[model samples]
Target: MVEVAWPVIHATQVEQVIAVFLSREHPHALRITPSQGDKGLDVIVEQADSTYHNFQVKYFATNLNSSQKRQIKKSLASAISLHNDKDSDFDLSLWILTMPWNPTTQQLGWFRQIQTDLACPFSCEWRGLDYVNGLASKYPQVVDYHLGNDKSRLEQRIKDLENFQRLRALAGMPSADSTLVPQDLLTPLAEVVQAINRDDPHYQFSVEAGPYAPPAVSRPGLIASTTIGETQVGPFVTFHVYARYRHATDDRPLPLTIHLNEAALTEMDRAAWQDAIRFGSPVTLAPGSFTLDIDLPGGLGVTNGEGTLRLFASDLQAPQPGPVRWVIVGPASWSVIAEIEVQNGPATRGVAGGIEFEGIDSTGIMTTRTRATPNPNGTFNLNVTISLAPEQELIGLPVAQALQILRFIDAYKPGNRLAFGPRWEPIVRDSAQLIQIDAGSATALISFLTDLNLVSNECGAPASVPNWRELTRQEFLGVRNAARVLAGSTARLEVHESYIAELAKSDIEMLPKGEPVAVTMPTQFELKVAEQKFVLPFTEISFSRITIESSDQTSPDPDRGFIVFRPMEGCEITQSMPYGAEGDDSLE
Candidate 1:
């Protein structure tokens, strides 16, 4: 009951249908005309001697309407002219083959009268959809060739087959040697069997009342029997036939009830399932290390420089299936680096110094820069600038953690170095020392020193250390020497090069600004100098002869400041003199 769009049917399919119909209806019919150059004739049949029959296959979306009839008449006229010009001696019969539609008696009579009035040695006939449908019914291949089966039904059948194959393979069963029947074809066979096996009274009573009826109920004889085998693989039982059937009839319904143990099926091949479920590629990275490279930034010789390099897997928790290798080669590079700790928002700010370094920021762009101070003995000082905004601190606590990792490279090390040919190469080491070099403000310098544990209070708590103003010049010198030693040992330095650079870079904007007002922390005042070298502990050091500088670039009132020093029990101040004053000075 499906209505087909006849207009969408290709002309080639119409020709094929006609050819197939003719081959079956008239086995000896010879097709003399080719499809392309046949004028109005699609196919030609040679009858007795000189008699010929030609068909013009016409498929229409609807019945032969007025417009369609006119088209057909024009084609007929063209055919008549071609026949007269080329084959005048032959007797020709023209036929218009179309889809199913019945014409009125008047229309048929009119067509016949027109054919008679043509005044040519030919006959005309109209074959519509009814005739085509009859041909299609007899030869169902015609319908299948034109209109395919339902796509959803085909897909379901494919899925069923795939499932069956997969399950059979999993169960380790031998595949069937014969081809499987398509679902579309098997459906009709199943319906026919169901119809014949119906429990209707007409069929049952007639068969049972016959002379060959039952005869003691036939003892329930076994018409056919086959063994159903089951093999247990793990918790699931795999059922399959082991041997071929000698003479089994499949017309009867199979007495099969398939019960799949879902849990057992899911548990099969646990390792493989887990492996398949994993995501992403696995990578192994070596721990971070330091590197010293010598470069000629200003056409100089190899200079000593130190930086740290860290390697980490882009994704660590997955397994990858390929070889892993690291390649390193480059000049120098720089990038803005910020380290943030969970407790403290932003922990550190610095720049990573390296060669050919690449890192993505929040904006998803790679940032890079390169600059180094060349020193003697192939040792160059790596100058990295770090910026800390005033607003980054919360309640006197640093926001960002201090920058720890400074530089990195992508190369693998062989022995003690990564050799990139003879011309360029950098020496790689496992560890290096980091130091604090300079600071912009006294608070910054004292904070950095306290952080390094170089400055501490009487209780030896670095956190209890007072502000910079409370510390004497001697105590400051002692703290600075301690910081220098720590820096040399660690090779790390806290510097404010970024602030200087920013000021220099924006000199035009700051030229008209006035001198900034002085700011001080009032609650913090005392700084006790801890033991330096062999000195006793808890010795409070205070600055004397304090001088205040004013914004006018001149010394302020000297009487405004006072000096006080808290000495230890054994210590005595024998003579006190201001630094750089020519006088007898001794500490006893």
Candidate 2:
């Protein structure tokens, strides 16, 4: 029996386990991820008939309760809304509420009541701990990777490692592993042991199962899969096998036998394994579920970035649901350090790394976090969060920026502020609010809404605000420009200090003087504004050449002077709004 605590498992792990199960059972039908902001639908299994079986997985450590019931309802409502949308991708036929733990008898009643109260247009079902355990009995690899215990395959691997360590310590081998050797076993016994370890190939590895398609989820009918396992093979996994043979040892390292429970090994994989016997680039001989790509820093063997093995379990979409079974059989020389598993699919918001830009304005906080993950396919997954503090951005958000924020305002929620670093680790924390709305917060929104020319400034009866779709193209253009400004992080000198008032009509602009020595004093300069041109008198003028670049600043007292000139306002630069047939699709 798999004696593992169900509730303690992370919600993400629970989701992956179910996904793996569905991927096996429904292989072709298991859609990767259904929705963008995934509110209702978590796992979508699209059958050949074009009908969808949607599962909303929840990691409720405890029995079903009122709060969970409410959550379930909300999720159902959201999923229904998606289905109602004409543009939606799938035809919803069944709704599944799945969790890691079994519910109590009373909890089951609550679940049934929820299903009945919703009066769902589609069939509804529940899957709990028993469902997962049933799958685990057959797919033990899943448990060995995620919910492992003392009696697990993972445990046996650990025991093997401990035994190896005991023997190594008994032999009193050096803490470091080495490969350089010219003599045979005639060297010291300890030296012989070290030499054997170098050639004997002590290595570990890992495997990650993903879709052959770039994103590995969402789209249906792609019908291909890939299994990537990495470990050292040539040196341990490279071409330096000659070094291993240098010291007297067994004939050669035994070739590893990789197994995929479902798909047959592709001819490419077979050829790759054949090449492995010759000790060519072993990177193609991916076999195990979890194989270390390289030795630890300063550990031993041909340790570098180039050492990695990749294998494939490619298969077309099968007609019916089945489990994904991947296995590895290696020689005694190559030990199973661990058969690790569990990972967030492409849709997971939690990222391996991310970037952030934040600033404080009027006691209100604003943050923009962005993460882009490139997929094997040309397309990529981009996650961006533009959050505002005091959430409603009351006092003043740039009018243009507020318009953009208002577009996706529904995604915002009220919460304390927190920041994450590149490693996706928390770097800052504060009572700073994520968002909220009230007279205080809405004050700015209200004033800005008035700018829309929707309501009258004259205080009177309350009226309905204009819809967001009602916004003009120019308004959207402003938002687009603002987004570019934030994303580009570019700056230019657009303004200058003031001078005389009599020159108010003068068209003034500054330009860098390329070569000072090329010209002397009394040089005339022409300035143009729009179609009109203006010339300023060179009275009391001085030139500063070094001001243009650092290399010119040869002296401590670099040239410091100004050539003052009057400037006139320029004509507005305008482009037609992208709203009609002639609209630009570049931004899209």
Candidate 3:
């Protein structure tokens, strides 16, 4: 058996081996050397579609340290910069190749974070020892050429494992004992769990909702109040820190330090405070004892309030003694008020505005309105109001439920066009029209064209008259043109600003209008040529009586203007007219 250390392999040799393997795997791919200052890309494979797959080879004996990791990050950043500068027309996939060892879990997490921060257009992958081993297993010749030996030992090791498994089965014994379990598999799981549960700072601290004052009714004084409390696990020194609160609508920070007092730190062990400064690292104290709470006088505004508290702790003692713990507290709250209103309703006895629909049991409805009002706008207005409870005032509205409600409301919007098929229906032309749209928290009021003295079969009116009476022929023609234009068009509807002001739930005060409502009425004339039947697009279609006689006979007088059909290009007029008349004038 021959042994070859992976760390001894040169970077250039690794690149060549990878190139060979890639070429074998993808016969159509073309390999090319990158030019000088080619970012982090050492070897590039170009495809027929102009897509580029880049590879960077690094051979190392041991795991990367913090500095080495930073170096790799910097190199990747430079490569990203170069890629952006070139603005290449093709998509790119970058592969970072390292041999002998894979990156640690922490290093992989860091790499993922960096990838997200950069937001590069290209895809990235980390090809470590496992990837190299995979390639070697597939192409033994390539591995032997580079490493001076085949994968005989690796093959033997696999056989040994197979033999061990068979022996264990024959003996009727368990396949794995504690001693047989590889340290690599167990160590990662143990370390990750410990790191998440203990070392992670987020798990060490927590913030909770506290006491609050009721919201005022006045416009300027309508301040929702709340308290913010933080709890830290284990014993640590406490310090009074400056606090600030930001309003949802404004960027200016409001001073919350006035509310901070010693009483807020009552949860912290008074006994621990005496020895906290004297104690060194790993000092033990009673669990669930360290806490700090502060009351917010003004609470969050009618919208939202985000508060941040900063503090410092001195724990380093022996070699370098200074403040070692730096804590930043960000506690947020919102004063959310959700209201929904409907415009008009039928009058009923004992109902103030309209009627109230309440849930029957104690487990009442979480959403939906119980009260409805009849507005003067000839519509029913249903109102549902929601305010943040004292406990939830600090956190504002629950994110999960709020998203669900918003999604439901979004799904309730009107679709584009209402189809009435080919049949014409009677539309109330002179009545007061009410357009009610459910737009989440906002009320939409839409105005449409009305009172047009258009031609209609609903009112028992003739299709066409000898003399235009109440409605002129010109007016009828104009209405037809307007209807055609309005068929597929869209219109915007206005939302009442007062509804938004009252709710304070959303900043959007308008529901954007949807596609125009089209009304199609039947025309007077229908034409049939051969097998195809055509409905005239125009509504003002009319027909008149006409007389046609032979050349030897005298023709009778024409009664009225005759309607003619003109065939445009691409239209096939298969049948000939009775008199052999052609071009421009075809009677239907």
Candidate 4:
């Protein structure tokens, strides 16, 4: 008999208990992870070595509440839905197991009252070790379902759930939700249910014989690691890991360990060494429950201007939840080996290959640097550099390897530090990504800014701290001229009193320069793609020499990515208007 232990187990426990019995009692058998789309069951056993029985597993908290009862009802409803599909004629036998006695006074009454209302191939049984003696006394054949037995499917399922839950806690996302038979899979589910519904197509399904014997349980295995986020901190690298597990008891701390390649660790650019420890708030492992978190680092903004950290895990040890490795990228001058062992134990060369960044920050913490610019055509150009400490050199990192390095470092060592070299390349498009600016039109400019809700600060804030007086068209134009100084990152296309000083400077610059430049001022521009439209407004007309090769630093590479416009032919400029000047929608 299957012996399943956990903080909770839903219907799947009952399936395992039954599997244990059938595996021994019947012939021509093999097991399959039950319900390809069903999350509740661990596996299903069939008679002809083909799909037949649809089993489910469930984990319930000791304190059953109205909500949980509702969930159970929901799960059952989904099972019925699956069974009703126009598929095979396999009979349905769903089993739900708890720690032992379950169902509150009200719930038990509800279950008793609603038993008939529940659909076919659906049944609920609540029993535990205490009931084992009843089987031994009356039906010794069901002994396979007992908990203490080896090779029991129930035991294995419990183990698998335990490990699955543990890793899930680290990943920080919910366990895989119930497998809704997508419309595509509905046909298959239908065929399976059609075969099991009845002996004759006209006859109704019947569970004439009571459960012949209890099913066996199998030990569930440890879950694999999942990566979360990665960031660079000078030379150090950090990674986050997640997995899941099932617990056999309550409040019991699960012994865990992490493994990483030592060679990769020693070769990583490490600023300094810090103790390795768990990365997040501690959690208690409850039976049948699964948890998830930011399992492996790679999380945005987890690194700083320090060193990159590299990681590796020990392959020999059983998997557990925790940080695996934390290695700092060292300086370029240092002499470090390419490989090392886990916990400084062994070494491997391939692990050291990957791109890495290094450098010193303005704060004196080591950091890396990279340059990025937008193209006039609206794409981005990125220059990234990777640094490695003496320790990171042995591996002579590859680009993909470098990504993993950043993940580990960011997870363990986090800060508002800068990254240098190739690591700092911008992944996002500049302000031009969603909007464009037109040149030399006042109404266009005003409408654009209006759409964007942008306002400038030419007139200083009135007596009110946050409110600034609205500048007139001329004043707003002047503010646009001085925007470079008045607002750097803070500047938008509108006018504000706080920017008055900068606007004055701009006014002076715009009057006249020694050489004649084809000066054009920015107007508001709007774009429509599909059904959605976006508007951009600007006060200043940014002019550039229309180079033979489009000069938009942020524009996409013409050869590789999309380029928006063709080479500019001589064009007419019918208008030289101020910020408030009105104009027809059609360009003259």
Identify the candidate with maximal TM-score: 2
TM-score of 1: 0.24
Query: Residue by residue across 455-509, what tens digits does model 4's lDDT show?
Result: 2222221111110133345444433434332333333233122111112232333
lDDT of 1 at 367: 28
RMSD of each: 34.3, 26.0, 32.0, 25.9
The deviation in Å at residue 471 for candidate 1 is 99
lDDT of 3: 0.36
lDDT tens readout by residue for model 2, 357-444: 2222222343433334446674434443444565533324433345333422432333322222222222222211233421123434
Candidate-wise lDDT, in order: 0.35, 0.40, 0.36, 0.32
Which prediction has more favorable lDDT, 2 or 3? 2
Instruction: Give the TM-scores of the predictions, in the order they appear.
Output: 0.24, 0.30, 0.25, 0.20
How do the residues 91-156 of candidate 3 rate in per-residue lDDT, one tens digit apiece? 566555445467889867987888888776677777777776676666565566455673455664
The candidate 2 region of ten consecutive residues with least summed lDDT is: 242-251
Candidate 4 lands at a TM-score of: 0.20
**Comparing 1 and 2 on lDDT, the stronger one:** 2
